[model samples]
Target: MKIAVFFVGEVRDAGFNASALAGADVATAEGLAEISIISGVRYDQDAIRARLAEVVPEVDGLVFIGGQGNITTPEIAAQYPGKKFAIVQGQKTGPNLASYDVLQEDSAFLAGALAARLTQSGTVGHLSGHRVPPGLKGRAAFVAGARQANPDIQVLTGFCGTQDDRTVTKAWAAAEISAGADIIFTMLNDARSGAIEACREGRARQIGNAMDWVEVDPEVFIASAIARIDLGVKGAIKDMVAGIIPDTPVHLGLAQGDFASLSMGGDVLDVHKEYIAKIAQDIRNGTCTVPNTYDGPEFQP
Candidate 1:
């Protein structure tokens, strides 16, 4: 069997790159399957349709790489009807499609709790690539968790509109810092580097996304919400190969080891360790559940 993986943008983004590599690696290691990758900067109907027209017929399965792009567009869905496709990070349901909805909001909530406990200024910041549902969901969950940890905490929010624009992200980070946000949680893809730079210059702490950032910037990065896309893609492909397609969305969270926050080698303050531990335990024990989208109550922390 062979699989074709489609990414919404350049392969440099850690989240998307990680998923593609994970899928390819799994296919290679499994010996019975082969995998290929196709990347595009645009998710427009025409672009996606053209790419799929060129790549879909040659592969036994299709994998949509992680990003904010919508995989359920009518054109793409109709073209690949009854063909096995695995979508990551976005929700789209079909008879032959399996969606891997990573529970990023839960990880964001833990990061928020840590920010509230660690910040000396009692103010936290959240920076997103865009105002899309995924980014907004993570931001809202983070703010809610921050308030749960510190009721009086002030949460600042901003967006860069695009993940590749670092200059705008730097400006937003500086502005958030100027507003007294001492700890910043960043969800931008490649734009996160700019936010990290701003945090370094402004002497503020940061929470990283997709993967840990302690090694990237030891002094400023306290912790990160790491997404295990490799495992997710492998699992999806394996299921398809085994003829075990799922009827509902495949939800992966802390409980399923799809996401985690590593404090090892982090710059987290001692005061925040207990709170982080508590939240992690609650997430594991099913005592705390965070929403994936804004369909829940408005988070005001």
Candidate 2:
């Protein structure tokens, strides 16, 4: 089967896009299908629609990479009902479409808890590039987790508007730091560099998402919310190859092996790790639930 993996941003972003591309590579390497990548589309509705119109006819199926697909992909999928469709990190589903979400919120909540425990100023920050559902859920989970760990801890959250613009992210990060946030949790793509620079210069530590930022930069990252977006991509492609369109969304969380979890740096204390572990278990066992939405005031950068 000829399948096209669609992405809105640069696939080599070393973050969310990169993880999804890795999954596509795995699927193609497994001989499951002839996978082609359709990437570099800006975060624009008309551009995405035009690209989809151009690509859908040429491929047997299309697997969209992120929550961005929740809108255009479904509209396009409905137009092409005979063609199979899937969205990794998406919330929507249909008879001819499936959405696979690797619950990054699970780990984001843990990051919030850790940040609350580690913060000396009693204020932590959250900065993401987009206002998408996944990022919103992550922000909500982080806030919920921090409140759970320390009710008095303050969370200053913002969406800076671009996933790849370093200047914007840096400005936002610096602003958050200046506002007494000693720890910041960031969900960004290539723009993460901007946050790292701001954290380094401001003497603030950071928590990252998508991939393990702690493994990438120990000095800047105190922890990373590991969400296996790659697995979701691979699963979507594998299902497409098998000609199986799931009736329900494919939901993978901390309980589902290593699909989602938190990776801490050397700065994290043993006691904190134990606490996070207990919380993870509670979430898995249905004793705790992570919030999937945030309606609070947004920090303007």
Work out the TM-score per prediction.
0.89, 0.98
- Tens-place lDDT digits, model 2, residues 91-199: 8889789999999899999999999999999999999988888998999999999999999998999999999999999999999999999999999999999999999
Q: Backbone clash tally for model 2?
A: 0
Give the deviation of candidate 2 from the true structure as CA RMSD: 0.9
Question: Which pairs clash in the backbone of model 2?
Answer: none
Best by TM-score: 2
lDDT, candidate 1, equals: 0.72
Candidate 2 — worst ten consecutive residues by lDDT sum? 292-301
**Clashing residue pairs found in predicted model 1:** none
Candidate 2, residue 25: the lDDT equals 91
